[model samples]
Target: MPTSKDLCNKEACDIQSCLKKNGFIPERCRKVIEALERCCEKCSYNSKHCGSMSRLLGRKDEL
Candidate 1:
């Protein structure tokens, strides 16, 4: 049986591409990150692509 694709992969890749184009200044990628966050929220944070979201959102302290 095949597994279903994880959610938010495109959003995550968009964030990476945005950050690269913006000299790794995450602030410039805020919108893409927010998009991924919204997708992750919809999936209840179960996506593998969401594994780094806490750190990306600067909420690692809560982890």
Candidate 2:
């Protein structure tokens, strides 16, 4: 059987690229980050990229 396509990869990459363009400032990448979060939520946080949510949100302590 063919494997399923991975989800949220583009959104995750967008966040990384946005951060790089903005000197690693999270505020500048808010929109992209939200996009990724939405994708993760839609997938029930099952995407591999979803594991970085807490870190991306700067709430690693809660994780």
lDDT for each candidate structure: 0.74, 0.74
Q: TM-score of every model?
A: 0.78, 0.78
lDDT of 2: 0.74
lDDT of 1 at 55: 74
Worst 10 residues of 1 by lDDT: 54-63
Across residues 4-63, which tens digit of lDDT does each residue of candidate 2 receive? 236888888898899899998787778888888788888788777878655885542232
lDDT (C-alpha) at residue 45 in model 2: 80
- Report the Cα lDDT for candidate 1: 0.74
1-63: candidate 1 lDDT, tens digit per residue: 312246787888898899899998777777787888888888888878888665785642232
Q: What does candidate 1 score in Cα RMSD to the true structure?
A: 4.2
Q: List the residue pairs that clash in candidate 1.
A: none
**Model 2 lowest lDDT segment of ten:** 54-63
Cα displacement (angstroms), candidate 1, residue 17, comes to 0.5
